[model samples]
Target: MVRILQQKQFVGHEIHGKSHKYYPLITKETYTKSFMKGFVRRYFSGSYRQMVSFFTKEDNLSLHELEQLLKELKDKNS
Candidate 1:
């Protein structure tokens, strides 16, 4: 837990006596987006299409699942 606190930028803590209280410094969505962007940049050369293609081919993501994901993206954009 101490190691995680040291690594994370979006976590804040308070110390009272021997006890500690931790809170988020950012929203879950913000953290996820930042983490995923870094992951994709590091592993996929910053290409979202390359990331999706790798998952669909190597991870054996079904066509139906791919269509569902596309629908969700479209819905979000709309």
Candidate 2:
């Protein structure tokens, strides 16, 4: 895990005696956005609409949830 993190430049750590402490080089939101961008690209052909449509068709979201998503999109566009 540490090796992978180091390879990605995603963390820095210090070794003391026999122990190590690690810290994140990137913020959680930044990492989440980066992960989601790759996921959407791979699974949805880079289309957020396709991703949302898949979720919607799965019947996983309630009416209120759908409305909230619509409102958020509207606000973002505005």
Candidate 3:
């Protein structure tokens, strides 16, 4: 997640564990499984070919099953 923007001062606000140069300051939202899958595909899949390669390599998930999941993910978005 990230946080609200602060003024671009020479320095930034620091509250012990608040934030730093590399750390994000905003919050992250949670999504359902179907949504997450679709989101991953939409933003990161690049193409169906890459998606299949990643799916199999990552978890040995069958292409057929991943295709089904992709459909479900599409449905959720629609």
Write the residue-wise lDDT of candidate 1 on 5-59 in tens digits: 5477667788999998888888989978999999999999999999999999887
- Which residue ranges in model 2 land beyond 4 Å of their true spot? none
Q: What is the TM-score of each candidate against the true structure?
A: 0.76, 0.89, 0.30
Task: Per model, state how many residue pairs clash.
Answer: 0, 0, 6
Model 3 misplaced regions, further than 4 Å: 1-13, 16-24, 29-45, 57-59
lDDT values for all models: 0.87, 0.94, 0.61
Model 3, 12-76: lDDT tens per residue? 35456664554333333422454567866797774666766776899879878888988998999
Candidate 1 global TM-score:
0.76
lDDT string for model 2 (19-71, tens) is 99999999999999999999999999999999988988999877889899999
Q: Where does candidate 1 have its weakest 10-residue lDDT segment? A: 1-10
By lDDT rank, best first, the candidates go: 2, 1, 3
Error of 3 at 12 (Å): 7.8
Winner of 2 and 3 under TM-score: 2
Winner by lDDT between candidate 2 and candidate 1: 2
